[model samples]
Target: MIIKKTSLVTETKDNMRGGNGAPVITHVIGGEILGNKGRLYSKIVMQPGDSIGYHQHVGEQEIYYFLSGEGMVKDNEETIKIYPGDVMITPDHGYHSIENTGTEELVFMALILNADA
Candidate 1:
């Protein structure tokens, strides 16, 4: 199945997971398409100073692949700088958060998969 870019769903999340400013989220595919394998597959765009607050994953794992701009990620207990082409993986029971610190918008692809699947 081919999912067109125009058919993707986009929305702005305010203080997402307790972050700072609203971040734009574009859903590349929904859970229905993933079937029991994952819950999220999307593109995230965060303006300067925007963030997705630290949170722990219970039964799922999330992967973030940076596409452009700069940012910082609090991966578990480590605070690391993120740049284009950087990838972060938060496994089940791990904690992580991200913040955009660049002048341009931070763009990334996020995928969350069920740990049991």
Candidate 2:
């Protein structure tokens, strides 16, 4: 049995350089959950004036949860301001992106579930 309690806090600036100029830390990844048909990941410390590129999933759906700060979520035809504790989801074939619109950093988590499971 795998049983343990631990305190884990990660600083995005410590690792990962985004394609753009933003900093991100991946708290969980594709292989973290085994035997599962989906993936879970988290990106924190998104500074103001930064964003994640828009993209779509071929055979999956994604769920986003904003933990702190404020931001904007853009899709094919809309851009919505997002506040802390907001939960947004993307359909199987929808496209979306996220941007930090606040002065401080934005932290968000994403979960992707593949359809072919």
Best by TM-score: 1
Model 2 residue pairs with clashes: none
- TM-score per candidate, chains pooled: 0.97, 0.75
In candidate 2, position 93 carries an lDDT of 84
In terms of lDDT, the poorest run of 10 residues in model 2 is 11-20
TM-score of model number 2: 0.75
Give a tens-digit lDDT track for model 2, residues 1-117.
342224333444522223244557565555356336786565566778777777877787778889888988886669999998899888788888777889988878877877555
Model 2 ranges off by over 4 Å: 1-19, 32-34
What lDDT, from 0 to 1, does candidate 1 have? 0.96
**Alpha-carbon runs more than 4 Å astray in model 1:** none
Q: What is the lDDT of residue 55 in candidate 1?
A: 98
lDDT of 1 by residue, 31-97 (tens): 9998899989999999999999999999999999999999999999999999999999999999999
RMSD of 1: 0.7
Query: lDDT per model, in order?
Result: 0.96, 0.71
Candidate 2 residue 76 C-alpha distance from true site, Å: 2.8
